[model samples]
Target: MADTFAAALDDFTRRDWQTLAPDAVDDPVRVAVVGLGWFAREWALPGIDRSAYTEAAVVCGVDPEVTAAVAAERDLVGVAPDELRSGAVAEEYDAVYVATPNATHLEYVEAAAEQGKAVLCEKPVEATLDRAERLVSACDDAGVPLMVGYRMQTDPAVRRLKESVADGALGDVVHVHATMSQTMLGELGTDHDQWRLDPDLSGGCALMDIGVYPLNTTRFVLEADPVAVFGTTRSEHAAFAGVDEHASYRLTFADGVEAMCSVSQTAQHASRLEVTGTEGRAVLDPAFYEREDREFALERGGSRVGVEFEQVHQPAEEFAYFGHQLLAEEPFYPDGEHALGDARALDAVYESAETGSVVRLDG
Candidate 1:
């Protein structure tokens, strides 16, 4: 069994996986970041810098001048948006990180796949399930590896939490509660036209943005898919326009497991994930974020035990893991299929919220 599993990994790496670019394994993975927005600048760039196995070699954005300035500042080649749209920029790097607006994920992903470059796209894959499926199919058809940027999947503490639950340490997971909230809109000096506020561009508001963290984390911990979802969403602030400012949803899984999630754009910063089982409960506060340290706690027998992990950088770990999969020819976790599942779930959440009814998922 061990040898067979190893052989499967080898086959996945050699035959099923395409290198980020030709001869990519022989050198540092060269990445062209397709969006220079806040996430790319603050999180992705810093993480790439910290990764010993990857480098940010190029940048592309909607504004050529800003893109050039950012590229120059980072000492990278700046590809024009048109060049990228035309798929001409794919040859310049080993991988492409699509950090563009949610609506634009399909265009960039298709472009990267056509060029046979490995793709690391920011979360949600696409705002809608159909588009997300198309993105996954594009990569599969092109024979290139496609990874979604779910940083928490690479966090050691998060991994340990999932493992503990799976190993029966928590004793038959029965329930999970997760919350991820942030204050983005109605904040001082915020850009309302940044595409995040527009449903046409963002797909949805708070749920599509921060809600996916709780939703995805619940799935990750349980290692199961929800059979049905009921959701409620609200736009409390006028700034939300056509999108939601807050969303709360419940997921009913097989075997009687359930998950409740809340996400908001109007609330103060808060994030947490808690899992309850027959034996004990585990909680991870501030569940999703890239930081140097994280805390996790366990409750059992009228007592609580907690631990803090140090030197944890989720983005850096994510890039390193991707490199490891590419070099070792192994299947990478949190790949496009994983993202597609999350997308479908989120779509159900929105549908349930809109119709004020439970959305039953098809197997």
Candidate 2:
């Protein structure tokens, strides 16, 4: 069997030539960035700022417009605009970033694993539990490192906040309220009928699209998973055939911490989350998309007092933060693993929507 990508670490570290050539470092992992659509052009590209990389590699994509544009703009050696869905991973590569729609996540991951390429897929992993599980099985069998792009988990402030909360700085976990919504009803009216809105592709409603963030964030902050979940999805425009454009949910954790979370594409609202505990509370307002800042609140006797401050790093900085973990073996990487956990939780949420009742995460 071929060695996993991470398996070369010890050998690279123990090389005797390192003493002679002090500048010698581990081999830089090369990756192919698939899906140059809206997300790749805007969000993921900015996060993976081209100038940060010192080595030479190619950027593979599907769209002609995107591949040419990306190649002209960035420092890529080779730009192969090929569809991953049509067997693009036939060539050898170290890693593949599956930036396509949520439905196609599992498909490309399977191909990457078959190619013995490590995968860094986008959020939710897949549209459904079965597909996600298939991806997990494929990667596990191949011994390839599988990571999901819940990039917020890589943020320094977010990680610290999660740790602080986990340490019981807020006494015992109590309640969580989170919201992420936007008014895309105008532009997306004709285009929104695609994979994202289709239940077959999207798997469900807004809860799956963006609401999963608060669900993941809530689980992380509260240090618990839902033992039971109840959710209702609704939409005014009703673009989705059966799924709701807006969804609100109530989750009861095993520790008795209750959370109410909502997501929507029907209205515009700041993506934010607030967590309260016995000792104190914290609020991650503007928490979705590109988070600007976060606020912390401590229980002041009978009243609650809070402080608001800007986040220390830029939006794209999270990519470098994640890169460093894979590059230099940084200790205490909370994001990548937590992203996996969040993906699992998202699967549970979809299951809840399917059954229309409180669904246990394990069940």
Candidate 3:
């Protein structure tokens, strides 16, 4: 936990946000959104409420449909929603959400940082180690927060898992095994391989895309950084072209406990995580992804350990919490700095994969 989080807890615990109207809070931040592609449609817009954290100042996109839809929905008064492009060079908005492809993350993020707006960048942060580092540095220099989309870290279930491990109920963290997968790859166009499928743009295939979850979650549950990594990769689908479709690897912590995991976009859709230690082990089904309706299990070796389940809090439900922190200026998520280190760890994973040798991260 960072000082900002500790301070936020101290400040927000006293506030009556619970009693305040669902729409009411302290001062609202002016929020701007960039890109209206998959994430904006499936998660973001629906996830954000107008009355919550920030008032929607402008919506930016290059696509006609996205612009038309966002404008029609928000009823943009001055600018056409479709007129906005990444970096949104044409117009300016207060806080920007960069939902562009993984490859484009750094450029747009730098723009938002330069524009002096809080940036909520979609995950992977960037395609390479240098890029993620530059984004973090720019945000730091600009005095802005660079938040990555590791939403599961805020989920109650995820919180409980981390707490349990922290309490030593899992004993000295020993070894961990986890997996995250989705549809192998999407077929976009005959000649049009989307940026995600392009190694130059996406940084990595499944490893950075869906693989980030396991990387983030394991670090959360273990409360440690992987000092070293050794791995192998494989690509089953043609979409991978030369990119690896599936990658499996092991991370060795300073304490000597290892995490052996597989990340794939080509296998059955499952987000499973298992942790083993001297005392017992805990398991979470579909661990990294938030599944509010389903239950997750905690266990000990051979024995059925009791696991308490709670309502998974959606970002929308929890976003107001962020607003309260902001109004108090206490810094909960406090912009996007929380996940910057995680992105760096992820970058190291790719470096190890590319070298086909055990790479030392922080050594």
Candidate 4:
């Protein structure tokens, strides 16, 4: 047992969750990453490099020339999407990482599932609820494991917060407040034809893109899904004409826990998640962004305890978790069903925004 709250938090942050698995494979799981986007190259590759249980065996993408170039640069197998879909290089890897756009996730997932490859798909699963369900079904039908990439769930600070909530230290969560935003056009340098602005390709703009972190991470911490949602959206820029540039939503959990969340595509960099309970409150400043260092604090009665943890790579931890589970034959926490629940909540948010009324979700 820990003598102090800070020690307890430190222990939680340092303990390796992967070792808790009953068993592990003798070798690293080879992964064929299906997407040559900036995220796949910049973040995912680095994660694969650092993860103890995974390796980048192949690089695939929609664009053949770009994929080949990346693979050659990294000395990895270069495969086109069509080749992967046709199982021409199925023997090259044991799993597939789908980092494609929202609407195109199903195809890559289906191909991987058909080849009996475990899948690690990015958040929201797909562009719409229907497509998301199909992606889950495809993996289910193929008997291949599927995990959604919710990197925050694996963050040390977030994990410590979850432990605090579960141990009743927080005395039953009552409300959560979360916010995440970044300047989209500033990052892109131009927003003439951003795929994120396309409703069909990327789903809703700001809400579906970055808003998901707060909503999904809150659910992970609370271990409960929202029962209903009330949301509103705005589009002030011409680039955001087809989708929202700003979004705010309220989620009401069945256990009476309420969460207020907001996200934007045109704002100064900011990210935070604060949870309040009957006895105490916990806050994670600089929460949604992976690059920023995190600071966690807990307040109870009249005193507060602040803790700091060494910054760990969020994407690397996420990849290591996925590979660990796959190697151990252990079921993933945020599996297909978990993603489905998130998809339902995201759809409800958009629905409420459109109807100008609260939307109730099916239990």
Provide TM-scores for the models.
0.90, 0.79, 0.82, 0.95
Q: Per-prediction RMSD in angstroms?
A: 6.1, 8.8, 5.6, 2.1
Error in Å for residue 276 of model 2: 0.9
User: Clashing residue pairs in candidate 4, if any?
Assistant: none
Which scores better on TM-score, 2 or 3? 3
Off by over 4 Å in 4: 1-8, 20-26, 188-190
Compare candidates 2 and 4 on lDDT and give the better one.
4
Q: In angstroms, how far off is 318's CA in candidate 4?
A: 0.7
Best by lDDT: 4
- Position 188, candidate 3: lDDT: 20
Model 3 ranges off by over 4 Å: 1-26, 77-93, 186-192, 290-294, 301-310, 332-340
How would you encode candidate 3's per-residue C-alpha lDDT over 134-193 as one tens digit per residue? 888888899876566666666655666666677776677889998887664432223335
| lDDT by residue (tens digit), candidate 1, 1-363 | 232122212221121233344344457788889988877888888888777668888899988888989988988889887787687756678888899999899999998888888999998889788899999999999999998988877776677777668766677888899998877855423667678888888999889988888888788878888899999999977779799889999999988898999988878877889999888788888787664256787776666766634646678778877765766667877899889888988999999998999998866
lDDT of 1: 0.80
Q: Which pairs clash (backbone N, Cα, C closer than 3 Å) in model 1?
A: 13-329
lDDT of candidate model 3 versus the reference: 0.65
How does residue 12 of candidate 2 score in lDDT? 23
Error of 3 at 124 (Å): 1.0
Best first by lDDT, ranked: 4, 1, 3, 2
The Cα local distance difference test for each model comes to 0.80, 0.62, 0.65, 0.88
